[model samples]
Target: MSAAIRNYALVTGAYWGFTLTDGALRMLVLLHFHALGYSAFEIALLFILYEVAGIVTNLVGGWLAQARGLRFTLFAGLALQIASLTALSLTNPDWLPALSVAYVMGLQAASGVAKDLTKMSSKSAIKVLVPANADGALFRWVALLTGSKNALKGVGFFMGGALLSWLGFSGALLAMAAGLALTLIAVAISLGSAMAGPAGGIKPKFRDVFSRDRKINVLSAARLFLFGSRDIWFVVGLPVFLASELGWSHIEVGSYMALWVIGYGFIQAIAPKMLRAKTREPDGRTAQIWIAVLIAVSAAIAAAITHDIAPELAVLGGLLVFGIVFAINSSLHSYLILAYAEGDKVAMNVGFYYMSNAIGRLTGTVLSGVAYLYGGLVGCLVTSIAFLTLAWVISAALPSRSGASTQS
Candidate 1:
């Protein structure tokens, strides 16, 4: 038991380090390119390859992890990120816009692969580390890992903006890369020689990436739209809107977004308590309820903005509610996917699940720029509402309880 606890802590810490760099990278690229007078849609284009790479990474990352062990995958992910950051540090700001975009896109794709590999490995480790007989322990541990991860990522966003403000683009990338390199060293030393695999030790096949479980499939589908709803507005639309339409400086924009993600993480950390998971675990009905509520909240925000009723307040204040609701929904979905994963093949299941997540982000990233360019924040919100509605419908089909057995 003590060994399990130690390993869990180590894996969680590694996740935190990786997520911090990942979040900062996003903010750095988005703000740096936007500052160069790139259009909104163009800014979105900068991240398109990032999501595309995620789709590919998740497809095979699980098989690699199951075969090689979690520590190997985790190490590989951190190393890749460091490499990507170093390469990006050499970007010459004086180059042609098209050339700069191409260079950044290719690097961003590498970072994307790094991000998912780290995520899949860390998440799968939880199943291996936690004893199966520990009822509801899975949800709590998952929440803590994910919640703390997002909070750190929020801090990273602020760090990115601050670094860019103080150090310039090239210098900021170099600084972050240096810090992450240290993190990788620390994790490598602390993790030592244990290349942990799942408790059941089942080897994963490439074909296992396509889920056979109905519950996993339904949850993955719902997850696709649920995340899409957020990124459609979040990735490019809202940040660009605040910067351009509202005339916010980079610092102000970064700070607000940072606070939002931080608070959202807090909500996620407490979601199990809020939902009273101690009394009864969340199931399909729980998902259905939260998602339906999210749909309503999204609609109200859109309507308020459309009516021009304190437009700024409507968007700002209403989004607070959105963040709160969305956090719970996401935390719930995270738990559900793990719950659905068979113990012998946790890596495979999580990999399949995040593949859907990456796809949704890709879709949303593409739309964020286009929507903001044409219809503004209101347009983004309306599209988000549609995505939420689709998620609700898909979530309704999820089994009230996961088909996976507690003992596997």
Candidate 2:
């Protein structure tokens, strides 16, 4: 195959594999912890550990990608991922629960490193493959791949759930480890034949690492608010509304998540056309503004659906609407990054995007937990409205689409 095709295929395949491993681990471990009698707070804490790992490695990965070149970073990330998974698979009986969480944390950190590195590297490679003015096209391609990654992750979750039911946690973990090993092999082969940069000899100072690219920093700020509201909608708010108020089973809820993911992927599959059309329009900023609004409206609808309407139908309906908003948000994020970020700092931009999201989730989850305790579903609705309004205001501070100023 041609060079461009080879690089895209390799990178896409590698992402698919990594996402599958991540999905399996997340689904299996949550159930395992629940079965081991961990409380909701403990479960959240474990996930928090994983997020912490991601936050640290995300920055490191960005710096490494900038200095070490794409191939080296990618290889190192894959190796670390494999080692972490193997260690998780081999944890002793006494360390079952404790080691399990630790193992997952390592995996998440390694995966974060790999993902951020690969993305930055791929962006560089893709830029060379496509013409300079075709950034819009590049955005569509990357968005489609991202949507595919989510779809594969959902499938992995579904499969993992089924496997966990049959093989138990240890069995599922072992199987996941084996799969991850194979994926690492695939990435290695792709790297061998792919056109990649020599590790840049640039040794960045601490100051440079900490310095925020003005454009990415602003985009990260918008993303933070967006995700903060999303956490309320997803983790605390959605689960409570579905289970306690609507009377859905956990399995049913899981199914709905998978369905939401499928719908998310479907919309993303067509995101290229959407991006193309929006690129031509004058209301890019207006459409971007509506993202937070739609999310807020969806939250309101969820509250309404649970109050007087059919609970189950309301959730399904809310999910469908949320899916559309999510797609738009995802595309807008990529567009903003490509439009404004410097070419060399894609990893930093992506890392900050996720780091902002992590902070948003941490804050939102805490507040939503409080809401769950004090006001039940209504509290969640209130929190959604409040935070989403703030998000709207924050988005207005973002640089408008007139190709205007991109302040940090």
Candidate 3:
């Protein structure tokens, strides 16, 4: 019933809507284009801009959020998504291949901007809305929001596939656009004007968008590798391995992936409880411990694949363990970014942190293809172990809970 809680709810709700559509759009584009006879690499090119655009969007979006408040950026993101969806719906089936690819990529770039802008806005809003005196509340809130968002995204993937089957591409896009428009209107009316300004009334300089805090910088570096570790195998290698080596059907592979994501989200939601977060706040030490565990798990999985020791069982069981540990690591990192952030500059700090995250994804995605082609799943797992080791080493520099304030 409190104003802060209400705003948090509003922001989370809007983000949920946006994430659902974002996931759906990705599936729609991939499946639709593949069905239209586009080569796999060409289809992948359509998403390259989406990832590339995120790097810039997070950097600039932070500054924009600081200047105009989280509300502005949130609205801008939703609006841009609506426009992007509508534009995609307008694509001409008869257009030349080059023209079509360029057009879709451009629209996907717009969607990327939309995704990051809304993400930064929603996440930054949490620091503003949560009372500073509430012990351990930040971690729980961040976990819930992030976990639920991922779960919904998995659902959206299914929804996208179903919609394409029922209504085709254009109809599905238009429907999603209309649904998002309504959510946008509802959010605009419910979230009050007080949410429309930067925290602490500070007029943040554009250059302030880059983080200066040593802890933040260290954490950012760790985050880059942490995500890269996941994507290196998760993106391409694992799926291909299941399909080709295990001889699984496409539906079976898709189902397993969707379930994995949903399960991972579930683990994330419960991470705070699993880690006894309420007993104490997490810090760099916490991240270091988790990353160390992840490194061991990654190495074990790679070894199993190399030795051909129950490879299927090893992959299935190892991945489950990896997912749980990684979720906790991810949840802790999310909280730390917000916890370490200066109140007035939370938007910019979150933006800068996520920029590193985007870069990690880009790196991992490209490496996933190359590694899988040359080294297969074992190679990808080896790369993941390397990335995790780097992340663990970098996390060693992070300040402890007692030292958190010194950096800020």
Q: Estimated TM-score per prediction?
A: 0.92, 0.86, 0.98
TM match of model 1 to true structure: 0.92
Cα displacement (Å) at residue 286, model 2: 4.9
- For candidate 1, lDDT tens digit of each residue in 297-388? 88887887788778788778988999999989988888888888887777778888999999998888778778887889889888888899
- Clash-forming residue pairs, model 3: none
lDDT of 3 at 316: 93
Candidate 1 regions with alpha-carbon error over 4 angstroms: 34-42, 165-167, 193-201, 240-247, 403-408
User: How far is each candidate from the true structure, as Cα RMSD in Å?
Assistant: 2.3, 3.6, 1.5
Candidates, ranked, lDDT: 3, 1, 2
Off by over 4 Å in 3: 402-408
Instruction: Kindly indicate the candidate among 2 and 3 with the higher lDDT.
Output: 3
**Candidate 3: RMSD over Cα atoms?**
1.5
lDDT, residue 292, model 2: 60
Listed per model in order, the count of residue pairs whose N, CA or C atoms clash below 3 Å is: 0, 0, 0
TM-score: model 2 vs. ground truth: 0.86
**Clashing residue pairs for model 2:** none
Q: What overall lDDT, based on C-alpha atoms, would model 3 receive against the true structure?
A: 0.91
TM-score, structure 3 vs. true = 0.98
The residue-by-residue lDDT of candidate 2 on 195-310, one tens digit each, is: 34532345555345553665467667766767677667577777877788778899888888877786787676677676564365222374456676565666657566657676
lDDT to native, each model: 0.85, 0.64, 0.91
* Candidate 3, position 228, lDDT: 95
Model 3 C-alpha lDDT per residue in residues 29-50, reported as the tens digit of each score: 9889988899988999999999
